[model samples]
Target: MKRVLGIGLSLVLTLGLLSGCGGTKAPAGDSNAGGNAAAVFKIGATGPLTGGAAIYGNAAKQGAQIAVDEINAQGGIQFELKYEDDEHDAEKAVNAYNNLKDWGMQISLGSVTSTPAVATSAETFKDRIFALTPSASAPAVLEGKDNVYQMCFADPNQGSASAQYIVDKKLGTKIAIIYKNDDVYSKGIYNTFVSKAKELNLAIVSTTTFTEDSQTDFSVQLADAKKKGADLIFLPMYYTPASLIFQQAKSMSYSPKYFGVDGMDGILTLENFDVSLAEGVMLLTPFNADATDERTVNFVKKYKDLYKETPNQFAADGYDCVYAYKKALEAAGCTPDMSAADICEKLVKVFPTISFDGLTGEKMTWAATGEVSKSPKGMVIKKGAYVGMD
Candidate 1:
């Protein structure tokens, strides 16, 4: 009888031990396999969530979140996303990358801006983590980085495309360019635009530059363009400086036809910005929220309903980035239980072969060099809204 009791007690103790072992949670960065919780791929991104460039960052985060929510609801493949604020700083971006790495980020949305993307791209390459940037359009962001890709048009492409569109439409006779000399994004676009303009025999009347310190005062640059009889001004910088330039130009009553690149997208939403100053502003961008396509209409409606504002090109690019990732991951048959390196390898192999159609572009394909091929659309700001220039 005593021996029977001992055997029963031992069996109960063994059962309790097994139960405790089963209840032990999986370590951080490991996919939880127990229960009905679906395994989710972890995606990490870093952008300027609280600085001057917060508009771009927040737009990207929200857009990507919407994609994630939709995908999660579908119950096919799920994703967990986390975005860190880099404040548009390169050093801070590197720190953010490290943080994401520690959190077991299986994939990365590199950065919203070029400088930070450039900084983080190196770390991703070193760590064998795949990255797809929504709006970091610099060539250097993809240079020597096979696992990194871009969703937005590269600076060179934007510059060359802008020049071609302007020439094709006969938008201006004499073009003047004002670019930030210190910025990689601005300088890259400026160089390509000048090359393309010259190739097309377009007359360039004035070319001026500004550094970060002198961006607020564009009076000298505008005066030079006006003096040179420039009928149109091309701005390859961001919206902040562009907004100031518009104000300064309006103050002097020098209203030439203003043309901009993707960097000028958020000007319409700029706080305290007078929409009248941008009455006829033209920009070469990939996404037009006012597009009548069903996908665009739905995305715009959802964005407005959730954020209470219109979605911009950056937001569209971010949305496209996630969908592109989804397509590639689905094509590659990647599982959430895979290691980050394995996911990176699968994505790097699969991205070149898949064609993605998203809010920003249709039939978008990535080159081996990680540059995305997509046509840009011309948008004109009319009555405080972006109208497709067609």
Candidate 2:
């Protein structure tokens, strides 16, 4: 778990040549579109800035800011990111959407949870602005919508992959899946894991779900799993609960082969939990470039130099996504008629061919379902560092 150091707001505003065509075109004769260009092209983000999910949101924002800064520095496209604090609440996410829409932002990357993301998507697509999430893994959020895309693989894949790994490792004949009942992200992954375990003929001794945003101890849950002879514990909840579980289990000497999906980001920050508990823990995530190629090595060094922290998958996705957009923009010829919607359309067509020479050495492409696809990479936490799973 990397320590999240708070950094002062380092928002940089840069100007780009805005173009135009019609209703969607640059507001007629606008300075950038005409002679005097404004100092920004706006993108919006809405995330939990002051709640349990703040770490995820802040990390994502930092990543996006880094991407925007790099883009602006290269004089490719200047992006102004209007960040709205959604407080990790769905209603607040809706509010953020309305506000950003009213402010005329065309793209955004945020809302850590699925419910808020789904709500925000409904509002955003109505306004024709696309929301590209870095960590929203719930498949339900993207059903029937063209404007919402998450750069990470869907939860189903992560769930199934984790289950398969557990089975292959022979870690357990019976397993317990601890999840948050109310979270779409958690429930989706949990259900998928259960299905996969069953397919592998593993006995699911117990499956339990707890309330979200609660602090009840996991002693009862852990005892139940123990009593059921469960040898593996699958937690599909986000960082906070997962950390709590790890801490409690360590206290009780209740070690099970821990398995999880990508939602476990930031678990490294749990001060009391032994980092060794993370050893052999299996979680599925997009290939981290640092785990793969030389290009990503350079990018990581550059990012750390700029932000004083190693970049996470969210930031890497944002960086790659911007490049994806740039390729599409150039493909569309940056005409006056190239509305954001047009760009998105071009993106859908071009995305399949756009390969990421990402930190994760795997070549990435979108499966027709809009979920990013690449060869599976296992992230095994070992000795305070995430080592690539073979």
Candidate 3:
């Protein structure tokens, strides 16, 4: 796992926009508008600032801050982001949301991963306080909610996409799954993949699982998968466990194609792990920092210059979401002092009509079901770096 350095609080917020059309636009002259006197829109962002997922939370905060700074520099509507760390715990995330709301925040940008985002949304599901998650992909996050929105392809979609990628490449007809039965994300993707693979007439040779508290060793599961002659092994979990699994698989001389999802990102930076362990490992993500498109190239450069490290998918999501929110606010003619309910109502009406083109290098839009229209890219690790699949 990547070590998270302590960052000062005063350093984080440093503190933390305008356009108009009548139907979707509020008069800049409205006293409730942010452009007016002493009206600063407050966005409360929650994520894992500490604990196992802090790396993702830190990236989200940085990307949001970049968007905040850039928008503030434009000198239109004023904005400030009040961020709270949930430590990647669902209950803690809910507490953070309540605390931010008490602190006067009307909008939210994240609860970085699916578990926490789902938790936080439960509290805001019927209210005006809207949430836009950066990386959470589980379908339940916004199942029937009107005020909540997702910023990535949902887990089920990702699973089906992975299955399609396998068929397209003719990589295998037999697949094995090794996932965490206790994790919402891993289990959700596994269920979808199993159904999709079966529908595609592919063979599922082995299905294995481990609880979150289980021992690190996966010897039994690995032996079973190998004995079943699996052409691919799916690891639907985060990088920490994924790294240990890779090391053990290499030790046992298992050389099947390994597959994963966005959570497998940052595997190359795992402490003391051999990058070679990830060679030929394939995963799905929306953003590749090294992508050559103009938007991708510029975002990567800005991210590297700001943090001295390449941006990950979560970071790109955070950046794009901020811009998306700005567009939504402008289109809805929202002002800072308007009732949270009204702001969200207007946004809900405006969202389906707009397309956002940002760091993801595609025009993204939302469905009435609150799903973000996105396609996952099949990426492979080669020479210790992510590259588009050949």
Candidate 4:
């Protein structure tokens, strides 16, 4: 049983300019309109429905769906969900966008990771549509744009929180930071973690970068860390590689305590992973399945009943992201003139000072820098259970 805290307000983002396209105001649930009969709004997602990153993408999809369901149930503004699979590729995301174009979708919830998010951001800006990513962590997504927004915290905040977790706990003196070189998401997280580690006075034993698609054989990195006598390792890679590295490290009888950024998830897929191997591994993430607040508990129950599986962190963020938009749309009075682009602009102006009662509890008001100011909680995988670490 996990304890729940207050809800938090998430990140604020400015999107790109909207093209002056003719807008349509179709009646709710018109199949001719390419939306559900009961839906007042239709949102699309371009995510990896299949492929290695599907776990993360699927979680995002589920989260968006949860929001749609909740909003429609209350009979406020009926919302519909549309999902497009990009298979975690940039080119495919464009193809997905073209598909949604025929469906007349203007507000999208997609592009889980940075690659697709970046690609879609350019295209959505060109189309003047509003694309909100709940999981994209790269800062470049928000650089001088007005149509894209991310609900999840960026790597800078997550990295700072992770570093603080180690420092606050006095977990280790020396740490190894492992990251992928070319990937924007991994690189962004690595940069933030490095900067924060220095501020926290944690000695960086090694700064190693790996090719995004290539394997980072732990042998070389571990040998280097062993040489430096490091006490902890911060592997800032996504789940696929992180799991492999963990297994490889265990094979070498190397068991330094581990910490990671939000890119790490799906621990159940790790190889040769027993309870002991994952004992002390921790991550700085917004998704906590163990929340205990009334809304959170209700959300978990409703989600499990609908999806027949437990909800992940990305899903939670997605649910919150849609609701945040819904709140702003409501404030804007969801009129025929109220386009997603208008809501996006309203989001930038509204988020800075608004408190949201989210599924996670009470989220703090949005920060002026476009990030959430709420304090983050830590979770450790102890004995196969994710427990909130104090």
lDDT assessment of candidate 3: 0.80
Per-residue CA lDDT of model 4 for 170-221, tens digit only, reads 8888998888888888888778877888887878978777785566576787
What lDDT does the true structure give each of the candidates?
0.89, 0.68, 0.80, 0.72
Clashes of each: 0, 10, 1, 20
Question: Which model scores highest in TM-score?
Answer: 1
What is model 4's C-alpha RMSD?
A: 12.7
- Tell me the tens digit of each residue's lDDT in model 2 across 1-390: 123322222211111222332223233222123221233455677877778787667766766665666666675455556678888788999888778767766556646567788778777566666567777778976787766777776888878888888777676777888888888888888878878877888788887778864546788888889888888888887767877787788888888888777767566654365666676676766646455467677677777887676666665665665555555456645432345565556555655565655443346666545677765667777776667766
Q: Write the per-residue lDDT of candidate 1 for residues 163-197, one digit (tens) a residue.
A: 99999999999999999988999999999999999
Candidate 1's C-alpha runs over 4 A off are 1-38
Better of 3 and 4 by lDDT: 3
Candidate 4 vs. true structure, TM-score: 0.85
Best by lDDT: 1
lDDT-based ranking: 1, 3, 4, 2
